[model samples]
Target: MTEVPLIAPLWTVQDVSEYLRVPVQTLYSWRSSGTGPPARRVGKYLRYRPDDVLRWLESLDDGAA
Candidate 1:
């Protein structure tokens, strides 16, 4: 789905996990450990920027780095 917001696109944890094919728990772990993309808090919920997610993904090597 296309991002609707005008600002940096916000993504749900599930979205990022699914896009990256990683388990949701991994995302939670990264978030709790502050090792992942910066997340925004809104009414106690966490949201990640789509662009940041993409950038973080590009940083992954998968044995290619």
Candidate 2:
């Protein structure tokens, strides 16, 4: 049997903010400073990939500390 991989869905700024529990303004600030997960502008809206966001969150985890 072969395993199937799930595809990550793209999220909006508002969605990402809510999921990350951060203010929308903070996400904008991070985007300006290039410190946030990768995002791309689709038309006039900003979109983020779930995979990238999860990876970024994982990077912030501090299990060793």
Candidate 3:
């Protein structure tokens, strides 16, 4: 039998901050500098895809090598 896959949940700024253990202000600064994970606008707020964040983090590891 085949099973259905589940969708990943979108993350909020606060959720990202907690996940990464970085301060919320730093995220804002990164956004201004275009150095943070890619996010999309939902109305007036920003939303992040977990996959994008994970890929971004992986890219950082790649740069360090």
Candidate 4:
């Protein structure tokens, strides 16, 4: 028998907002504008990959203009 980890690090819009210090409404706007981190839709809910978010942050810092 394998032990499963409880409480994954998956984040909702609110979580992302807290992490990024942005408003949840901005997250929604970014999601719709296709300017946010690539996300996986889990049952109609947006789920962001931590790696993707980090990468996005790095890219932005690198002047991805």
Candidate 5:
């Protein structure tokens, strides 16, 4: 039998803010400025992939060094 891996749920703006320890407004500002983790527009809401968020954080670390 083959095993399947579980998938993570898409994150909301509030979820990303809490995870990154930033204000929700900051995320909105970053989004507008095109300097934050990538997000998708789903209907009237923005959704983020957890993997993309982690990659963005890692990129920051890479740039800092």
Candidate 6:
């Protein structure tokens, strides 16, 4: 039997925007300002880990309290 590696699919800027209910432009702005969820430069595009996005959202909750 061969074991397969499990990897979560990274999200595109549009995917993140849709999930967060923000405008696509807003995500780009946040990226420029260095205030959005952490992203990686893959080739010439930005990719986000789902865990990082969820963690960022949880951090916002922490700041609210």
Worst 10 residues of 4 by lDDT: 56-65
Q: What is the C-alpha lDDT of each candidate?
A: 0.82, 0.91, 0.92, 0.82, 0.95, 0.94
Better candidate by TM-score, 1 or 5: 5
Model 2 root-mean-square deviation: 4.2
lDDT of 3 by residue, 1-65 (tens): 99989999899999999998999999999999999999899999999999999888887855544
lDDT of 4 by residue, 1-65 (tens): 99988755877777788888999999889989999877789998888877788788777755546
Q: Which candidate model has the greater TM-score, 1 or 2?
A: 2
Task: Tell me which of candidates 5 and 6 scores higher on TM-score.
Answer: 6
Off by over 4 Å in 1: 1-8
Model 6 poorest ten-residue lDDT run: 56-65
lDDT of 5 at 59: 82
Q: What is the C-alpha lDDT profile of model 5 across 10-52, one tens digit per residue?
A: 9999999999999999999999999999999999999999999
TM-score each candidate.
Answer: 0.72, 0.78, 0.82, 0.74, 0.84, 0.86
Clashes of 6: 0
Candidate 5 residues lying further than 4 Å off, grouped into runs, are 1-5, 62-65
> Model 3: clashing residue pairs?
none
Candidate 2 lands at a TM-score of 0.78
Model 2 Cα shift for residue 45 (angstroms): 0.8
Candidate 3 regions with alpha-carbon error over 4 angstroms = 1-5, 62-65
TM-score of 3: 0.82
Worst 10 residues of 5 by lDDT: 56-65
Number of the candidate with higher lDDT, 1 or 6? 6
lDDT preference between candidates 2 and 4, better one = 2
Q: lDDT score, residue 6, model 4?
A: 73
